[model samples]
Target: MTNEQKALITATVPVLKENGVLLTKHFYNRMFTHNPELKNMFNMGNQQSGRQQTALAMAVLAYAENIANPSVLIPVVDRIGQKHVSLDIRPEHYIIVGKHLIASIQEVLGDAATPEIVAAWTVAYNQLAGLMAGHETNLYEQQTHKTNGWTGWRPFKVGKKTPESAEITSFYLYPADGGKVAPHQPGQFISIRLFLPQLNLKQARQYSVSSTPGHEYYRISVKREKGANLDTNGMISNQLHDFINENDVVDLTAPAGNFTLAPDIDAPVTLISGGVGITPLLSMLNSLVENDYTHPITWLHGCRDQSVHAFRNQLNDIVKTKDNVKQHVFYNQVTDENREAGVLEGYLDISKVPSLNLQPNAHYFICGPSAFIQKQYHDLVGAGVNKQHIYFEEFGPQLLSLN
Candidate 1:
């Protein structure tokens, strides 16, 4: 873009800050109305919660702010690229999105969206779209080239569904074609798409692969999200828990995520989780154990109580047999039995436990709610852990700022 175009984009920063969500909301509504079929590819739960709109708004604002050197956003781009690859997003889809986005900006801005302003945004959008398309193409290529890997969506059948907790169930998914499945990186996730009868449209959600890699089937532990009364936040999860059954087929996109454990790392590893966020971390832990990791490993988990803590027996077996592994459990609602079991009351505070082996060179992986992640990240940084060594995974929108 020309200097004037870049300046124009930068000038819209204030407006974007004030009404960015409004613009994105308009864009989504407009796009969905015109291209209803695309709804199958999006997380309607996020749309209803307004998370997708807010996330997109922030991304657009960031792009505009860094128009002169957008390469600085490569990390953010790569993260989004992984998500896009999992959703099977293609270049053609970006063209549709760009059209609706530019139209939404014009409509939201009214007469203020002059031809020059619209043209500038068009160029900016195209540039971003090109960058994203290129990155996603490479990601797709990587997936296809991997052994037993394929692009787009593949049919998978639920081979087994085991209740891990009162609210969480683990589904073992096997390829419907009876072919070998691609081995995913520990800590990665797969996109599962299902049709919702009430909404009359399909919805997709990314669930972390709970089991270790190199297995014929992938396992995803899902928590039935019973939201507030009449809330749609848990529709997909609720449907999966209530309706999905063994042998039922579902569409699954290939595994894609940047949050992965380096298998060759020979340092102390600490895994921390709160509530249902243990899914991905559990995969990392299992992988480490399978590889016979000799480094000190600490498992820290927090939940309401033992009843809601998934994988208790499995974790217990590991704790009992693995001398290199140590664990500490925190319960929000503890009982006398819990006290006898050595469970701590209240939230997880690493400072309170000195046995976590907080070595300066050790790596820390955290997964949980946004607030949980924020607190743990801040606490770890404050406790002298290097910012680069601490990685986190948060479900839903990517709004948290680790920096």
Candidate 2:
């Protein structure tokens, strides 16, 4: 954009911050009203929970704040680009989003939004959209070119469903046509698309691969989200839990995500998780045991109690057999039975746990609710673990900052 247009965008930085959420909320409603078919492409669960609106608003504000140095947003864009590829978001979809975004800006601002400001935003939006589209295109190409990988969506059949706990269930998926499946990184997730009969629309969700790679089937464990927020206790998890059964067909995109185990076998590896966030770490843990991770493996987990602790038996077995694996189990509601087995009571406490003492060349991977992940991250950082060695995964929109 010209200097005048850039200046106009910069001038709107305050406006973007003040009304970003309102504008994005308006944009989503307006777009859905005018183009209802696109509803299938979005996560209605996030919409109801206000996560999508908040994330988009923050993204817009950030882009506006960094208009002069768009490169500063490259890391953010790349993370989002990986997600776009998993959802099979195409370049053309950005065209629709840009139109609604600009229209919403004008409608929300009224007379204050002059034509010149709107025109400036048009250029700015195109610039940001072009960058995202280009990144997503490259990700899509990488997925398609990988051996045994397919773009868009490929049909898979549910081969098995095993109950991991009261809340979590594991689905074993295999190609419907008996084709080979790509081997995903230990912590990567694949987007699974399902048709929701209740809503008369389709929805897609990303579930981390919960099993080790090189298996004939891909395993994804899902926690049945409950409660009032349809966005959180939404359609996809419920359908997978209740409706989808063995042999049922679903569409899956190739695995995509950046949260994975760093290739440093000799580093002291720490894997921590709470509740169902253990899904991805399960794969990482399993791989570590399989490869006999060449470092002290500290596995710490927190849960409500034994009843909800999925894979308890398997985890216990790993700790028993692996000399490198040391463990700490924290139960928010512990009984005498758990105490007998040496499980501690209450939530995870990094400072209090003896096992949390700093180790040399340590690397930490944490996954859980955003607050929980943040707590662990901060604690690890405070305990002398370098910020670069910490990796985390949040279930909803990645609004949490690691720095």
Candidate 3:
């Protein structure tokens, strides 16, 4: 974009900060109305809860705020690229979004949107769309080139459904084509699309792969979401829990995510999780154990209690057999037996555990709620852990900026 266009976009940062959600809401509404079929590609649950709008607002505000130096937003771009590829988002979708976005800006800004300003925003949107499309193209190419990999959604049949806890259940998905599946990075997720009869539309949700790679099937442990009154936050999850079953078929995109463990790294590794966020971390931990990683490995988890702690026995067996593996469990409520077994009560507090390896060479991976990840990140940094070595994955949109 030209210097004048950049200046215009920078000047609108305040507007974006204040009214970005309003703009994005308008954009989605307009786009969906014009192209109803495109709704199949989006998470309608998030759309209903306004989470998608809020996430898009933050992204737009961030872009406008850093219009002069977009290179600084490379991390955000890469993260979004991974998600887009997993959803099978293509260049044509970008064109649709760009058109609706420009029209939404013109409609919402009204008289304030001078022709010059609109022209500038159009250029700015095209530039960002171009960058994101290019990045997503590369990701799609890489994913399709992987062993047993293919682009777009592939049919997978639910081979088995096992209850992990009161709230969480594991679904083992096998290729309906009866072929080998591509391996995924330990912390990666796959996009599963299911038809929602209530909305009479298809919706997609990304769930972290909980099982170790190389198996004939990919496993995703899902926590049934019970939304509060009038909330649509867990529509897809509830559908999976209530209706979907073994032998049922669903469409899924290949695994894609940047938050993954490096099996080759010979450093102390720590895996931390809260609530159902343990899914991806469990994959990393299991893969490490399966590969016989020699470095010291630590697992820290926090949840309600024993009844809700998924994979309790499996984790216990690993701790008992692996000398290099150490486990720490924090419960909101504890029993006498838990106290006898070294289970700590209350939330996860790293400071209370001095025996944990805090060396700079150690790599820490955390997956959990946004607040949980933020607190863990700050605590790790405060405890003299290198910031670069601390990585986290948020279940929803990428909102937290630790830097």
- Estimate every model's Cα lDDT from 0 to 1: 0.92, 0.88, 0.90
lDDT of 1 by residue, 1-403 (tens): 9999999999999999999999999999999999999888888778888989999999999999999999999999999999999999999999999999999999999999999999999999999999999999999999999999999989999999999999999999999999889999989999998888878888888999999987499999999986464223377788889999999999999899988998678899999999989999999999999989998999999999999999999999999999999999999999999999989999999887866668777999999999999999999988889999999987877888776
RMSD of each: 1.3, 1.5, 1.5
Cα displacement (angstroms), candidate 2, residue 164, comes to: 1.1
TM-score of candidate 3 to 2 decimals: 0.96
Worst 10 residues of 2 by lDDT: 226-235
Model 1 global lDDT (CA atoms, 0 to 1): 0.92
Error of 3 at 197 (Å): 1.5
lDDT (Cα, 0-100) at 29 in candidate 2:
97
| lDDT of model 3 at position 5 | 90
Local accuracy of candidate 2 as per-residue lDDT tens digits, 211-294: 988737799999887776456336789889999999999999888898998656567888999998898999999999998776
State which candidate has the highest TM-score: 1
What are the per-residue Cα lDDT tens digits for candidate 3 across 1-403? 9999999999898888889999999999999999999988887767877888999999999999899999899999999999999888999898889999999999999998999999999998889999999999899889878999988999999999999999999999999999979999999999999888878888888999999998488999999876464323377888889999999999999999999987577899999999998999999999999999998999999999998899989999999999999999999999999989998999999887868778876999999999999999999999899999999998867778895
In model 2, what is the error at residue 383, expressed in angstroms? 2.3
Give the 10-residue window scoring lowest on summed lDDT in candidate 1. 226-235
Question: Clash number for every model?
Answer: 0, 1, 0
Which residue pairs overlap in candidate 2's backbone? 45-231
